[model samples]
Target: MKKINLNSEIEELNPEELDHIEQALLSRAQTISKLAYAPYSNFNVGAAVLLENGEVLQSSNQENVSYPVGTCAERILLGYAGANYPNSTPVMLAIVAQRAGEETWASVSPCGMCRQAINETENRYQRPITILILCANGNVLRVKGISALLPLKFDDLNS
Candidate 1:
C-alpha cells in the first residue's frame, strides 16, 4: 500500500497588508456579522463575496431552535449570489466571526457543509475564489481556492 499526503498553503498576513478591495470586503463582513441571528449558539459569523462584476455581497449566519435547520453565512451569501447574480462569478470570499458578547474577533473556518458549498460554487464558475479568513490575533489567513480546503471534494460528474 502507498501512503499519499495532501497539503495546502495558507498565507498569514496582517490586516494592513491586504489590498484596498480585500480590506473593504473584510470590513463589510465584520460589519454584517453584528446582524447575525445566532441566539442559540451566540457564535456570529459573516461572509462577503466579491463578484467578477465588482459587486460585493455579504451575509450573516441565521440560526434556529433546530440547529440543523440553520444556514451558514457562506452558504447564504453564495445562494444569494447564485440567485441574484447568475452571470457574475464570485472571485473572492472573506469570512469573519465572533462571540455574541466578545469584544474581539475570533478565528474560525467554514464548516464541512459550507466548504462543500464553496467548492461547488468554484466548480460551477470554473474559477478559483480567493478566501480570506480573519484570525483572532487580528491577522488574516489567505487561501487561493476551495481545493486548498477540500482537495478531494465530491464531483457530481464523477458520480
Candidate 2:
C-alpha cells in the first residue's frame, strides 16, 4: 500500500502588511461586494484581478432565481479578463464577501468550480496567480496559486 499526503499553506497576515497594490485590490473587492446580486443567499461576494498589463478588473457575484444558474464573482472576473485581455496574465486575485446588511466582512473561499476555473486560467497563462482572501477578523489570507487550493485539479483533456 502507498500513502500520499497533500498540503496547502495559507499565510495569515495583518491587513496593514499588504502592499499598495494588494491593499487596493482588497479594497476594490470589498467595495464591489456591495453590488452583488445575492437576493437568494444574501451572501455577497466580490473578486478583483490584477493583470500583468497593469490593468485591474473587478466583478461581483450575480445570482439568479435558479441557484445553479448563478455565477461567482471569481468566474465572472476571469471570463472578462480572458475575453478582454487574452494575452495578459493574471498576476493576483483578491476576494471578499459580506452578508447583506451586515457591517462585518466574512471569511470566504472560492467554490470548487471557481477553483477549477482559476486553475485553468493559471495553466492557460503558464504562470501562478497569487490569491488574497479577506478574513472575517480584518486579516488577510494569502495563497500563492490555485494549485494550493485545488491540488487534484482537472487537467486539459486535449493535452
Query: Which candidate has the highest TM-score of all?
Result: 1
State the TM-score for model 1: 0.98
Least lDDT summed over 10 consecutive residues: which range in candidate 1? 150-159
Candidate 1 lDDT tens digits, 25-106: 9999999999999999999999999999999999999998998999999999999999999999999999999999999999
lDDT of 2 by residue, 34-121 (tens): 8999999999999999999999999999999998999999999999999999999999999999999889999999999999999999
Evaluated with lDDT, which candidate comes out highest?
A: 1
Candidate 1 Cα RMSD (Å): 0.8
Candidate 1: where is the Cα deviation over 4 Å? none
Over all chains combined, what TM-score does candidate 2 have?
Answer: 0.97
| Residue 114 of model 1, lDDT score | 95
